[model samples]
Target chain A: MKGTFRASMAWLHTGLGLVTGWVLFAIALSGSLSVFREGISVWMRPELPTVPVQTVDATAHAVAWLTDHAAKSSAWYLAVPNHRAPYVFGTWERPDGSYIQKALNPLTGSPDGIRDTLGGEFFYRFHFELQLPYPYGRLIAAIAALALVVGLISGLIIHRRIFADFFTFRPNKGQRSWLDAHNLLGVLAFPFHLMISFTGAVTLVTMLLPWGPQAVYKQDVMAGYTDLDPALESRAASGKPGHLTAITPLLQNAEERFRGAGISQVYIYNPSDAASLVTVIAGNNGTVSTLSHSLTFDGTTGRLIREHVETRPAVRTYTFLYGLHIARFTPDVTRWLYFISGLMLTAVIGSGMRLWTVKRLRLPHHLGHVLTDRLNVGVLGGTSLAFASYFLANRLLPPMSPHRAGHEVQCVFIVWGLALVFALIRPARRAWPEMLAACALACFAIAAVSSPWTNPVTQSTALVSLLFSGAFGYAAFRALNGKAKQT
Target chain B: MESAGTLRRPLATAGKSLSLKRWDLACRILAALPGGYALAAFSGICLAVWLPGLRVERAMTGMLTGLLIWPVAFMASFAVPDGRKMLGGTVIALLALMGLAALRGWRP
Candidate 1:
């Protein structure tokens, strides 16, 4: 009976190990790759010459420009450039107050052709959003994360000599290499693994517990928000046009109020009206999740309203934790650590799946092994192909072209599908090298093509990217040059 | 004293009826969910201060809530050895918390 129970656990382990392995690997790998989302964004956009830190006059500039350019705006937001960001971005309500975001040249405060880049935000959104319409993709990713968490926990319980095998990675022992790599990576960065799961769950807590705030507050979320950040009630003036002045004095006043910490944004509400307010959020650069401090003033008389004169306790705690999740709050050293850790997390999951498939090769006809092997190729190889395609799509597709994003995504899916097909149709022995070569070819081709695009990143950076792309191509060719080597 | 010890072993080790060590592990896992619910719910409560928008305030509150999920699980496991019923308890607690929040007018 005891033996039977153990056998059942083993069967359960094998079943899950085989079933969800590739999906887990893909998620981890993509997540790790996305750690450099910002860097990649920098590579994509063209260089913008730095402007003088003219934020003292930012609110004034916005008001002046909008008054001349966007008179009769109903809804508006003012975004001032900071040390980290290269441009000021904003949108205004046109008589009706709907939002329309645009990039402003801080020097002249005018819209330019290049103001369209969302940069790292694309990958950040893609990492979880998966581009599927609404809750479906998000729900799938969340369920995958839960599966990953359960697998990791069960793995720890099942592992016999966690420490003894911590550093022991034996090669050429069928599943040994993959298993060792998985165990080593997983154990070393176990904290990161665990945190990612829980925080990921935290990120999805709303979805997980949708009923809480829904039931209790009767959906008066705005009222609830008031409880969180206390706001002053500004009396609405008589339903008449109130004469207004420029926002220069108020801008300087807010800057003076912030003193050392620079002002990152200026929000002018009810502009040209008596009840108009200007909120200047002070800047602290290079942090995750952009919420900051500053002063909110009456844009009319420039009287001080709610001033974040000091670091409020609740706000500080909130920013710090968000920083941890986004890896933005840390210095370069810590950010690099997070990136590396994220990468290792991907490798661990990838190898874990491969190891399981290899171990299961003894099963009848070994169809499962064949499926897992193909899956491994499809996921890892397909990932490289997808990324390469994105780079290619970005380069080939017109920058101003409205369908650019959609085309790029299509390229990724198409390349990934091709890789999967190639994996399935070809012999497992030949598939690895074939797929590697294919990925390399795509990467190099894309890198070569990208040079023609007038992107912002420095030429030196692009050339280096090209060189690395070529290097990968060369390695793939060299590996496949010989007879196909089966694991 | 010996009889009491033996009685505890039957329930703790072999577990109830046909349940065994795997069941214990399952219990641990099951117990964890409710605790996680509480922890997350607490974080949700903190976030109500800045509802809808996942602003800095909400993010900070979320971190606090995220940490609670584990401890709640740990506590539930230690206090109630039964695997399934505590899950029921957790659901109740979560539902109640949500209902209370909704009753208070939390919304989109």
Candidate 2:
């Protein structure tokens, strides 16, 4: 019974790991890194240098400048600076209604005109929502997160060694290396695995929660969100027109009210109306979640109606957990930590796939290991090919090509498709070697070919970018040409 | 020349050669920097509690709540050690921490 049980457990883990592993890892890794997307974007652009004595006047000035220049905005979000964040970003709804983000200069408090920066938001979107169409993509991502929880729990139950494995990495040990890597990955943030599982699952609880709303609340799901947050009803307009009072006063009042809460953004709604609401959202640096501790003031009368800080006990706990998951007001180092774990999670998925193929090939059975080998090469090789090609296409395509984004996406899929094709014709062992080398060279060459054509950066920056591409290409090429022959 | 017989032996010995401790190590290496971040995430939250301005108390029930994760994560590392190994590693790590702390004070 014991032997059978262990065998079953192993099989189940392997199966589960193989099935949803890639998606789960991708989600985890991307979400992890995105924790610091804002910070990373600033560092990457390096447009904003630190300055002291930045004023609410300067911030208001910037907002005014943006509002004047904004030919496309209906609503504007002005991101106020925190202790760690250097610059503020104003997000506005474009003509198409998509959120367009612009960085605000800390010095002049004006729009800095830095463009093409989706920032860490892209990764975040990819991680959780995966660019899938709204409800479906979100649902699938949530399910994958649930699978991760399962994988994490089952892994703990099955692992016999609780300590002996801490600092063990024996290199050139074939399958042993993989096993070591897997264990090491699992162990590193075992705590994170546990927290992320619950938090990630909770992050999507609206979808996962027992169809209580569908069964009970029916059409009143909006009521659930509103009930959970009673603050929404505050400052609701009574249909009278009046220009807004000075924003500076509201900002000051909010700062005083929240005290340590660290006011980050002042959201003004129903402006020039008697019922306008001015909400001061707390900065995320010191906070754990995105649940804003807001104090809403009426527009004309200037009276405080609701404060998130003054919520009931049950609602407060609910908000706290939600905040923890959203990681609204986390610090710089913490966000980086999120990013690092995210990268590791990606590696976990990739490695798990590699292991699946490796084991399948090693065990030559009635079914030839051909499919497994091909799958390994296709997924691993194809991912590299697709990413490299996308970068290449990004540079090579016409600057004004209406189809540039589509074309870049096409190139990615085309290379990915070629990988599957290559696997089919050749022996999996031979296919891996040749395709990897091709992918490497293609990656290296594409960067070189496109550097002069459409790159927007300076010569040095473009060269550095090419060099970066070359490094990865070289690594891939070297790996494919290694002494470790396909068995 | 004597390999045909030996080739089969490996498959047979696969089960016997399996090391839970080794497997544990492999997972950790894979976990990498993110693993550290995961801990940092919680600790980051906990640090919020330490702030004087935020009304969090030492009496929160969940203070010990997260301690449970340390064992789970550690055990997941497959770090089951004898009394001596665990004690020795802990002592060494603590000594290192102290030295670093002392250096931090001195430098400042």
Candidate 3:
């Protein structure tokens, strides 16, 4: 019975991994890129330079600017300057329910006339949304995450030699080498993979299983979300007009109360109204809990309204899971660690696909086997090329081009589609090297085309580009030199 | 090697039941989807009721628990190797949870 159970798990792992491997790879790779989303945003906007400034004063200046220009706005969100993002960002909702976001110059407290590109937000959104309309795209991504959980669990259960094969990396053995690398990557970061997949699925749990909340809240799920994160709590705008009080004192009070924990976001609800209130939420840099310690102050009188520090175990567990998944509390070194782990996860899926094809290739004239082999190339190679093309397109496209961000995303899909076509026409052996070489060239070019030494963010971007270029080059070389043996 | 032949033999026998295999695949797929989802929700709610929390916490925890367990339920539907048994086990669990909830008036 034990042996049979292992066999059943092996079969389950193979089927589940193959069926959803492509989508999982795409999600993981994009998420890996998004680890440096803020840096990428800074790099994309070359005009923004890093500078040292007090976050409290920056928020005060941004709020001052908003007071003059958006006195009647319903609400205002102030993102204080930090290391990754060196500019004060503000977004406000108009009376008509539209929002305008702008980067305020630290010196001038005015909007930075940078290019209207999606910047890092594109990859961050595409990581889960896949650029499809809300709810449906999220739904599909959630289902794929579930598949990943099953794949991880079943793979763990079925593998017989866990410790023995921990350090195995036998190159040039083709399929055996791929399986070794796959197992090595999976086993090394098994905890990370399991945590990321499970929490990721839990992130969308309310949407996936609304019945629990519906039963409790009687169909008002928004209230559930608000309860989970009280920073989302809001009050309607009172029509009574009033003078706006200075927000600097309120922000200073929040900073004092939180004991120098950086303020990530400050929201002014019903600004310039009698009922207005300001809420300052703690930044993720201080702790591994996404639920920020918050302080709400009356907007009219600058009086402290409410203060909260999460103590509930359930909320703490949920937020810890969220924080672990997002990794927002980590420094640059730890962020890179996450990026590496994410890359290994993607490689695990890719190598599993390769193993599937290699095992099936021992047979002859099986359409399923051939198709899987081609798709293996198309997905693994095509997605890498698409990502490289996204960076290349971002650099090459005109800054003022209308729909510039959409076009950049379109370039990704277009090149990826072309790779698919190439995979169909060319032999799998030829397609691997060709697509990989193209990706290597593109990555190298992205690094080469950048200026020598502008800032740390740009320097880091260039370094990452070079690293990817070298990795792709090595993969291409291996594919070109290795004999295509069916063993 | 004859080992490859031996590995292929079971699949060859599976191919002999082409129509029956198709039916079995369809049944398992159904069981994995709806059957598994129901089982997850029922069991999740049952677990949530035992947890110490308020209404929102319990609801969120139950939803999270359901989401985490749904994948396990899905794989179990295929792992058991018998679609009927998988379906029957899920239904029985669901009914049992329902009985508990109905008898106890399950509320957060």
Top-lDDT candidate index: 3
Q: Candidate 2, after superposition: displacement of residue A461 in Å?
A: 13
DockQ preference between candidates 1 and 3, better one = 3
Residues A204-267 of candidate 3 have per-residue lDDT tens digits of: 7766777666666665767876777665566777788876678777777777877856788888
lDDT of 1 by residue, A1-487 (tens): 5433333334434444566666666666566556665455545554444454566554455566677777556435766655444555667877555555565655666654552454555557666666677787676666566656656665554454567656566554444555667767878888888777655554554465543444344547665444334432234544456545557776777667656556666766666666776676666554343354556676567777786433555555545444456654556576667767877777776666666655555456477668767877888777767766676676666777764555667777898888888888887557867777777677567556656545434343356456646755675564465333324
Q: Which candidate number would show the highest TM-score if scored against the true structure?
A: 3
The residue-by-residue lDDT of candidate 2 on B7-75, one tens digit each, is 332212212222445544444433322342233224323322332332222111122222233334433
Cα lDDT, model 3, residue A470: 93
Give the docking tier of candidate 3.
Answer: acceptable
Give the winner by DockQ.
Answer: 3
The A-chain TM-scores of all the candidates are 0.76, 0.77, 0.93
Deviation of model 2 at A330, angstroms: 4.1
The fraction of correct interface contacts reproduced by each prediction comes to: 0.12, 0.00, 0.38
Reference-based lDDT, residue A168, model 2: 54
lDDT (C-alpha, whole model) for all candidates: 0.58, 0.55, 0.77
DockQ for model 3 equals: 0.31
Stretches of model 1 off by over 4 angstroms after superposition: A1-36, A50-80, A91-103, A135-166, A210-216, A231-277, A285-294, A299-302, A308-318, A365-372, A403-406, A417-429, A445-487, B1-67, B70-108
Q: Model 1: which docking level applies?
A: incorrect
